[model samples]
Target: MGSLTVPACVSTVLLDIEGTTTPITFVKEILFPYIQDNVKEYLQDHWQEEECQEDVQHLRLQAEKDKELEGFVPIPVNEAEIQQIIQGVVDNVHWQMLLDRKTTALKQLQGHMWRAAYASGQVKGEVYADVAPALRKWKEAGIKLYIFSSGSIEAQKLLFGYSIEGALLELFHGHFDTTVGPKVQSESYRKIADHIGCSTESILFLTDITKEAKAAKEAGMNVAVVVRPGNAALTDEEKASYPLVNSFEQITLHPVQ
Candidate 1:
């Protein structure tokens, strides 16, 4: 951060979801695994229901689309065909497609149910140890907190609302999802600035990925890339272009007078 230099104008904070607040591996290895483990049961239990069937089928359709694009013919899923979908999930190949609208929405709801599992000691959110303290200090400093993540808004809510350490959702004042735009694109940050009602200069973006930080910086926000373990392994180019911090604790804030 010392090298990249915090802009004097930054006032509010815009953060990423997976690596910034929660661990990436946590989502990939734990949360995703939980959803996969219970997916068949959840789908089976809710197949006939209106709300549930639509979502499950919606995901299947998306999976089919991906397969079709990959040149594999897809089979439609019904009660009898669902087992194959579960097989895809269990194999962990199809699970990455959770980014799709239908699957993403379903994943959001599943996060809520996973809350019970986490609350009952079945799972834990893998936030880095540096997370809680930095969040507390920043909140106390009156840096307005906001979220921008590809994860659906509801999933973001569930994560902080029923986090590993208990509910930390109250720390944030607003949330933005992919509905704004993709994280890698420039427009998403522009829309987020409008939504937050803060000048782009007043917003500081914190993420573990350099590409996102670069995008935010291009959008005129102060950018800090976290270099946490289990975070993305940056390329040499990423290293030169952004200020890097090993942890949130390394972030030093200077108030604009």
Candidate 2:
């Protein structure tokens, strides 16, 4: 693994979940498949609830735009159209999971479904072996930790709260999701830095995605591109452009100024 000295001013760590702290297999093999298998039933069971209806409406709006983009005729949204809309939304959610799209509405709905799964012992979140120890070390060192993932904030909490490492949610100071901005956008990192009351240069952003790492770097944050089993392989050019680490144990932070 490659290494670089963390800047002395760094005081906060922003972590990406899927491939940074957790193995990608847990998402691909467990979470996504669980949602695909359970979502339609979850929707049918909860469709009348206020929050579920709101999310269904949001999915309806997205489905409408999708139909328009595909040149399909627009269906009028009405009480008579409600079941059709719900079914369409369910089909769309399945398709999005197939493609691994990270739209906010989809994530919000997934979080709700995963909430039930976690509560029922049907699924448990999996983090890399190195994550818990690293989190503890960083916390002991007084570096505030935050999660910035495409998952909804609720989903983030559920994952850590029910993680295999056991109720690790309390280890984090805050969480951010697509609600802030897309992970690949530099503006999102800037927003996170401001939200955390830290200078961009004083935060270290860790992710397995090269584009996200580059965006954090462009936002003036210290960035590390992580490499792990089951993560997307980085190109040689990408490897050359960012500091790379294979494990969180390799990360070392200096005291804040």
Candidate 3:
């Protein structure tokens, strides 16, 4: 595919993680599985910490709200034994993950687990070959950059901070997660622009999801649909509606006059 020329109005770029910068396989084959396999041991190791306990409490609350759903796992509220409560939280996490729910409770716990994993060198964040160099070029050009992903902010930090590229966090000005709003919501894009102290038109957002591209467009931001291996195929209509790039190197930023 030909290169994508970003408009001169763009002063900031917001990036998506899963399928935009990193391969979907890294998240599916590595990150998520790590949580499922190690959640039990992580809980046992960190249960005494206030932060871990707080994560457990959040899960308990989310579990309470989920009780009406069929096949919902329950977290023990007043269980006598610590082991029983831990077991309950573990079960609830497994159930939520199995169903691929993105509740804050689930993300909070997952983020904490990933932090330890990254620190201990159990996992390293993956990025495409062209991502770092392209980002460096943009930063040197005085274009600000930020990340917007469904992953928790802490998780985002861990990924970039311990990335295979080695601490690429310096490349970003900030990060946003679902705490701001769902990625498919136009308002989220607007809120991000506001947070960055820039006009929506001055920010370009890149994602593999057409819904996210559409939403950012609605919010008046420039949008690009990233095409990467393992990303969902875009429809003909989607291809017509948005700029598409197979790699960051394909995107050339035009300086503002």
Prediction-by-prediction clash tally: 1, 0, 0
Better of 1 and 3 by lDDT: 3
TM-score of each: 0.79, 0.85, 0.93
lDDT (tens digit, per residue) of candidate 1 on 21-140:
777888778776687677666656655678665565555665666673533334355645667754543333234534333455456446555766766677755567777787777788
Please give, for residues 1-257, the per-residue lDDT of candidate 2 as tens digits: 75467988888999999888888788778988898888778878897899898887777676666764443333346566666765666677877666667766777788788999998889998989999998988888899999999878888999999999898999999999988999999999999999998799999999999889989999999999989887888888997899999988888787543
Deviation of model 3 at 29, angstroms: 1.3
TM-score: the better of candidates 2 and 3 = 3
Worst 10 residues of 3 by lDDT: 73-82
Model 3 agreement with the true structure over 45-138: per-residue lDDT tens digits: 9989999999998998898899899899888776558899889988889899899998988988998889899999999999999999999899
Model 2 CA lDDT for position 91: 75
Q: Which stretches of candidate 3 lie over 4 Å from their true place?
A: 77-79, 255-257
How do these models rank on TM-score, best leading? 3, 2, 1
TM-score of 3: 0.93
Candidate 1, residue 6: the lDDT equals 59
Of the candidates shown, which would achieve the greatest TM-score relative to the real structure? 3
Ranking by lDDT: 3, 2, 1
CA displacement after TM-score superposition, residue 178 of candidate 3 (Å): 2.4
| Residue pairs with backbone atoms closer than 3 Å in model 1 (clashes) | 11-202
